[model samples]
Target: MSVNIDLEITVTGPLDAEQAERIADALNDVAQDEGIQHDISFVVDEWEGRIEVVGGTEYPLIITRFGQWQPTFESRVHGAVQAVALAAKADIKWGYPDDED
Candidate 1:
């Protein structure tokens, strides 16, 4: 049996455009460093699986993993998200059932 998961990550806290860009950059860098293939995007409008990043920390940025993934792949993504959160100086909250710290 294949172990798969869907991760919805939200990093909360005050953020300007520059900070948001930095977060995205850090995520990409971590993904590259760990050799994890992913498609990550920042949106200003509501997406299918997420809401828009409005002003204030209440509607902060969100990062999500779609489809199925192996446990190892899930671990890599979790690590990468941690790095991104640290670099962005933000708080990470795992959404729904995949909540881990």
Candidate 2:
């Protein structure tokens, strides 16, 4: 995609430790299926940029772009995040300042 995107994931409400773990697991599973290369286990400060996780203990499922931007890869990652949110039954949102949608 030619457009710039800021893809960051954050929990919507009060996310307890247990729920966070489930979200992590779900994200991992979906990421694996989507063939994501970067380590989304946590916030990779080395990425070009990162969005801060607001109020709570930072949750791990962050998907950061590593190299040349690939729209299909990012699209799959977004889809994976959506899948994780559905599986965990949690309210998760992805996208940042530059995102149009």
Candidate 3:
């Protein structure tokens, strides 16, 4: 049986092109280091010239799908995210997509 898992990481801030690229690179490195075969993508939302005040630190969202899931998958994912967050100086919110809906 093949186990597949989808992950979503939401970063709550404005992301520029460079920042997005950095995040993507970080995610790729994470996946590679963990021996996880994954397809990762990113989405950066535009606020439409409207400045909405967020009460806390903002981060970027990272979406990844794994070809196989293992028991320690979540921890591996978190570790990856943490490494990126620390390097980027950002906060992150993440979860499995299936758990959302």
Pick the TM-score winner. 1
Angstrom error of the Cα, residue 12, model 2: value is 2.8
Best model number under lDDT: 3
| lDDT (tens digit, per residue) of candidate 3 on 7-100 | 3444434445555555556655555665442444444433665221111113222333432344355555445545544433333333444455
The C-alpha lDDT values of all candidates are 0.40, 0.40, 0.43
Q: Model 2, poorest ten-residue lDDT window?
A: 50-59
Off by over 4 Å in 1: 39-101
Q: Tens digit of lDDT per residue, candidate 2, span 1-101?
A: 24333334443333444544555555555546655425344221212242222211123333356344446654554454445344322223443435443
State the weakest 10-residue window (summed lDDT) of model 3: 51-60
lDDT of 1 by residue, 79-99 (tens): 644554443233233233334
Pitting candidate 1 against candidate 3, the one with the higher lDDT is 3
Task: Provide TM-scores for the models.
Answer: 0.40, 0.37, 0.38
Candidate 2 yields a Cα-based lDDT of 0.40
Error of model 1, residue 56, in angstroms: 21
